[model samples]
Target: MSALIPALERQPDKPALCFGDVVLSYAQLAGAAYALAGKLAGRGRVAVWATPTPHTALAVVAGVLAGVPVVPLNPRSGARELAHVLADSTPDVVCVAPETELPEAAAGLTTLTVTLAPPADAAPLARPEPGPDASAALIVYTSGTTGAPKGVVLSRRAVAATLDDVAEAWQWTGDDVLVHALPLFHVHGLILGVLGPLRRGGTLRHLGRFSVDGVTRALTEQGGTLLFGVPTMYHRLAESAGEDAALARALGGARLLVSGSAALPVYDHERIRSATGARVIERYGMSETLMNTSTRPDGPYRPGTVGVPLPGVDVRLVDDDGERVEADDGETVGEIQVRGPNLFTEYLHRPDATNGAFAGGWFRTGDVATRDADGFYRIVGRKSTDLIKSGGYKIGAGEIENALLEFPGVREAAVTGAPDPDLGERVVAWIVPADDAAPPDEAALTDHVAAQLAPHKRPREVRFVTELPRNDMGKVMKRELR
Candidate 1:
C-alpha cells in the first residue's frame, strides 16, 4: 500500500504483473483490487490460497487496500500444516481463484473466489488509509523447524521500511523489470519479489516454474533488469552457463542478481562469475525479520559474506553467555542478534515463544555467524545444527561445506556433525557427486578440506548421495539429515 496509490495514478497503463500469458497493467490491477476491497471493506483477516498466479497477487493487493491482514497459505502444504495454519490464523474468509479446489483444511471457512479480470468501467475507489504502522499486514508462518509453524506478525511499517531500505541499497528504481520463479508463500517471493517491485512502481515478470530456459528467456527477452532467485536456481544457471551463451549473456546483462533464502556456496558464486561477469549477491533474513543484511551494490562484493546490514537495521553477534562478540577478526563465531524496525512484532498467539526469542532488546536469530572488521557478516551455521564442537575446538560447518564444494567431482555439499567417542562431535560431509561413475575418493575429499581449512576442521567422514534434501527456498534440510 506504500506506493500502490501513486503507481495507479502515475503509470496506470504500465505493465505491473506478468504471469504466463496473462498481463495486468497497473490500472487493471488497481481496478480489480479496488472492486475486491469495496466488497471486503469490513472483513477481518483473510487467507489467500497462495499460487504463482495473477489471482493470488490480486487477492493480496485487495487485502492490503482494505487494510486487512492477509495470511498466505502455501498451495503445496500438507494437510496437517494447512490445518495448523488455518486454525491458528482463523481467518474470516479464504480467497482463491475460480474452480480452484480448496484443501480439506479450509473446508469450514467462508470462501471467496478472486476474479482475475476487472470490469472495464470499474472506477478506482478512494484509497483507504492503512490503519497504523503497528497494525499487522501479514501473518507469515515459519518453517516449523522447532515445532508447529508459528505465525510471525509483520506490520505494515515493517514491510514498507524493509522494502524502502532494500530499494536504496540495491539502487532499485521504476525502470527495472524484476524476474523470478520463487514460491509466493515466503517472504522472499511475495514480499520482496512481488511487493518490492510494486513499491518501486516497477514491473515484475514471474516465471510459473523455475528453469534455466525460463530465466534465460525472461532476462534476454523481457527486458528484465533485476533478477531474484535462490541458490538452487542460480546453481542450475551456473551449471549450464558455460555451454549456454544465451543464458550467460542474459545473466551478464542483468543489472543485479540476488541470491537469498539460503547461502550461495562460494563455488557456485565463482562459477557464475566466471561464466557471466556478474556477481550474484547473498542476503540474510528470516520470517521473523523480513531482511537483515544484504550485499550492497556500491560496496565491496564478497563471495561468501552476506554483506552489511541494511539502512535502518542493526545487527550484532553475541556469545552464549549473552556477552557481545568483541572480536571482529572473522573467525570467532557467535549467535546473531538483531534489532530494527524491519522485525516482526510477535509470534501470533504465542507470547511465550515471542518473549523467549528476544534477549534484552535484540531478537536472537539462532543463526551463528562471524563478523569482520569491515562489518561484513559470514554465517557459520545454525546454533543447533551447524556448529560442530570437535576436539574442544568450535568449528563452523559452512567453511567446510564450501571447501567440499570446491572439489571437481562434488556437485553439492552439506556439512554437519556426528557423535564420536573421542572428539565429542565429528565433522561429517554429505556430498552429491557431479559424476556418480567417478566420484571423488573420501580420502581425497578429506585432504582437500584439511588443506583448505585447519586440519581439525576437516570432515571425519564423507557420505555420498544422489541429492541433498532441500526446502522450497533451497535451504538444505539439515534437520532431516540429522
Candidate 2:
C-alpha cells in the first residue's frame, strides 16, 4: 500500500498548512495530527464538521493517521441533510473547532474540539509508523439525485494514487504553493485542495472565503504559484479581473490555474485567459473516482476538454449496449468508464448500490462524453440529466450552454431535456441574463443558439430566472431544472 503522504516527514521545518495567521509547520502539523490520532485510535469512524480552517484540516489528517475513516460534515448543510449523514455514517465522534456551534442533528454525538497548535507544555514531535493505507480512509457522500446521499468509501491507496497521478499531470511539486477559497467539505475542496498540497509537501493558503482581494492576497503576497477553484469562483474572478489589475496580474503570473467540479464555460475560460494570459486547465472527477483526467501542464491548451487520461487510469467510452465507442470523431458521445487504483473501495453499507455501480470490475461513472482522436475527453453532461435528445440527435448540453454563454446578454446558463410529445426529449435552456431588466427574449436566444450551433440543437424553450439552483461546489443541479 502506498503512503497517503510520503513526503511529510521529509520537511519538518517547512510550512505545511496556513489559514490567515494560523500556520503549521510540517513538524507542528505532524505532531498535532499524531497526538490527535492517539486519542482517536481504534475509533470506528470520526466525523468532522468541515469548516474552512486549519482545525478542520488537522482533524481530517488526524482521522486518516489514526487508521479511522473520516466523514466530512458540510458546515452549510441543512439540518435534514446533516441528520441523514450522521445517521448513515454513525461516526463514533464528531470533531469541530472550539467555538463552533453544533446543530440539532449533531446534538447527541460525542464532540471533540480540535486544537491546532501543539500543546505548548507538551512533548516533542513524536511521529508514529504510518497506519493502513488500503483500508477505508474517507466516506464522502454524493449530492443525492434521486434519494439520500450515498457514502462513497475512498481508501488511502486510492488517494495516494490519484494525488500522485495529478502531481505528475500538473507538474506539481514541493515548491509549488497552492491557493484557494474552496470549502473544506466535498472532494474538490477537501481531498484535492487541502490534502493535495499536503501530499505534495507544499503549503496551502486557504482564502477562508473567496474574494478578488483574497485571491490577490494569496497569489501576490503568499508566494502561491498555483490556483484551484471551481467554475463559479472562476466566473467571479474573471468578472473582477476585467477591472481589477492586481487580480489579473496575480492570476497571470501564477504557474497554473485549475478549475473543476463543473464545466468551466468556454466564455468564462476565454475571458480569464484574455485578461490574465493564463489558461484555466479543467479536470474530470467524481466522489467515487477521485480524479481521472486533467489538462496536463505541458499539454495543449484545450478549454472545455478535460485532458487525456492520467498515467495509471484506463478510460473508455461505452454505448448503451455496453459496447466500446472507438470512434474518436469528437462527436460520438458515450458514458465514461474508468478502471484504476484511484477508484473507491465501495459505498458504505450499500452493497446493492456498490453492485450496480460497476460492470465487470469497471466502475460506471454515468457521465457521457466524447473522446477526440487525440484522446482528450469533453464532457457532454450526465446521461440521466444533461444529455438532451432532440430531433433524433444526441446533443450534449455543454456545447449548447457554451453557445448560449457566448451571447453578450447571458450571465449564466443551464441546459436540460424535457419530454415532448413529438420529439421525445426537447432541449430547454434556463438563462440568467446579464441585465435582468433588459433580458434577452426567447425568440432572440433561440435564434442566437441556432446561429452559433445548428438549428436542431437550439433550445426549444428558454426560461429566464434570477439564478440557477447550485450546490455548495457551484455545480448547477440540472435535475431541479428538468
Candidate 3:
C-alpha cells in the first residue's frame, strides 16, 4: 500500500494489469486486493502459487496490503524442490487460484483460493502509513547451484528502492504501457515486469505464454512503450523477425528493449538490431541484490555491456585477495562486488550464509565482469564456471561463447572449465549445432574461436548436442554441462 497506493488512488479507473483477455483496472485491483487483505490481515507469512496470471499478482498485492511477507513458489518446481521450499519457508497459508490444483508438495498447509475479479460488495480500503524498513516483503529462493536453494529475505524498502531507481533510469511514467511474457516467480518478472509498472501508475499487458505473435500484437495494439525479456524470448523474436515484418515494426516502435538473467549473445543482438534497428539493452543483477546496474534508456547503446551502475548503487571489481581491480582497460576479469540499499537483508533461517555473503558490508557477487573506460560494465560469466585458467592465462568463457555464436553453424553454446593435467583447466565447449546434418566440425569451430580471440582461448574440446540445458529464465546451466 505504501508503494503502489498512490498510483491506484490517482488513476482509479485506469487499466492496471492484463493477462491474456482478462483485464483489471486500478480501482478493481484495489478492491480485490483490499477484500482479500481483510481476510489475510494477521497471517504471518504466506506462499502463493506464482504463475504468469492475474490471480497470482492479486494474491501478492493482498499480502503487501496486509503487511505480510509473500513467498512465491515456482509452479514448475519438482516434488523434492517444492517440498524443500515449503519446509524451509514454513508459510502459514498457501494461496492458489480458484481452479488451481495444489502440487503434492503443498500437502498439510492451509490453502486459500484467490479470486481475480472483485465481487459486488468489495471496496477499496484506506491504506495505512508505510511500514518500517525492516519489514519483510518477499522471500525469494535462489537457483541453488551449490545445494539446496536459499530463501533470500527481501525487505519492502529494498524492493521499493530498486523499483524507483529503475523507474528513474528508464524514464518510466504513467502513460507508458509495459509488455512482457515471463514467469512470475523470479525478480525479473514479478518484481520488475509486474510491480514496476504499478509503481509508475503504468499499464501492464502480460502475454500468457511467450510467442512472436503475442509480443507483436501487444506492442502494436496495446500501445506498449517498453518490453522486458530474457535472451530466449529475444532469440525467438530474432529468428522470426526475418520473415515477419510486423514483428520488426512492433519492436522498432517500442521505446526500449531490455534483456537480462543471462547474457544476450552478440549474434542475437546483431540479428535483432539488423532486422528492427533497435538495440536490446542489458542489465546485471542477482537474487540477493535485486538490481545493481542497468543501461540508461536515453544513453548510447552498447551491445555486450550491461551499462553503468544504477542510481544509489555502488559497484566495484575485486581480485581474489579482496584488493580492487581497476577495469579502466576493460579486459581484466574480476568478481563484482556491490554495496547499496537495493540488497536483500538476509537469507531466511541461514544467518551464517547471510554473514558470509557480505564482505566489509559489500555483497560479493560471484559474477565476473569488466568495465570499459566509459564506465560500462560487461559481464564475462559466473566466477565458478566461466573463469577458466588455461596455459597460465585467465580467460572468460563469455567472450569465447560470444565469438562462437558469431560463427556460421553455431546455434547455442555454453563454455565451461574442465580439469586437465596439462592446462590445469581446459576450455571445453558444449554446443547445440545449427544443423544436425551439417554440424560445424570441432576443428573448424576451434579455429574460428582461435581467429576471433587469442589461440590460447580456443576450446580444446568441443561436444555437439541437440540442445543445452536451460533454466526457467533461459540461462544456460554450465555447471550441469561440466
- RMSD in angstroms, candidate 2? 1.8
Candidate 2 local lDDT, residue 27: 82
Q: Indicate the TM-score of model 3.
A: 0.98
- Residue-level lDDT tens digits of model 2 in 1-482: 11676666678899999899888998898778877877887788899999999999999988877778999999888889889999999999999998888988789899999988776543322445344454688999998876899999998888888988999999999999999999988898999998899998898999898888989988988999999999999999999998999999999999999999999999999999999899999999999999999998788988899999999899999998999999999999999999999999998889999999899889999999998889999999899888888778999999999999988789999999999999999999999999999998789888999998899998988999999999888999987776
Measured over all alpha carbons after superposition, the RMSD of each candidate to the real structure, in angstroms, is 1.4, 1.8, 1.3
| Better-scoring candidate (lDDT), 1 or 3 | 1
| Cα lDDT for residue 123, candidate 3 | 61
User: What residue pairs are clashing in model 2?
Assistant: none
What is the TM-score of candidate 2? Answer: 0.97
Candidate 3's displacement at residue 120, Å, is 4.0
The window of 10 residues in a row where model 3 has the poorest summed lDDT is: 123-132
TM-scores of all candidate predictions against the true structure = 0.98, 0.97, 0.98
Lowest lDDT sum, 10 consecutive residues, model 1, at 1-10
The count of residue-pair clashes in candidate 2 stands at: 0
Total clashing residue pairs per candidate? 0, 0, 0
Question: Tens digit of lDDT per residue, candidate 3, span 15-79?
Answer: 99988889999989988888898777777889999988999988988887777889999999999
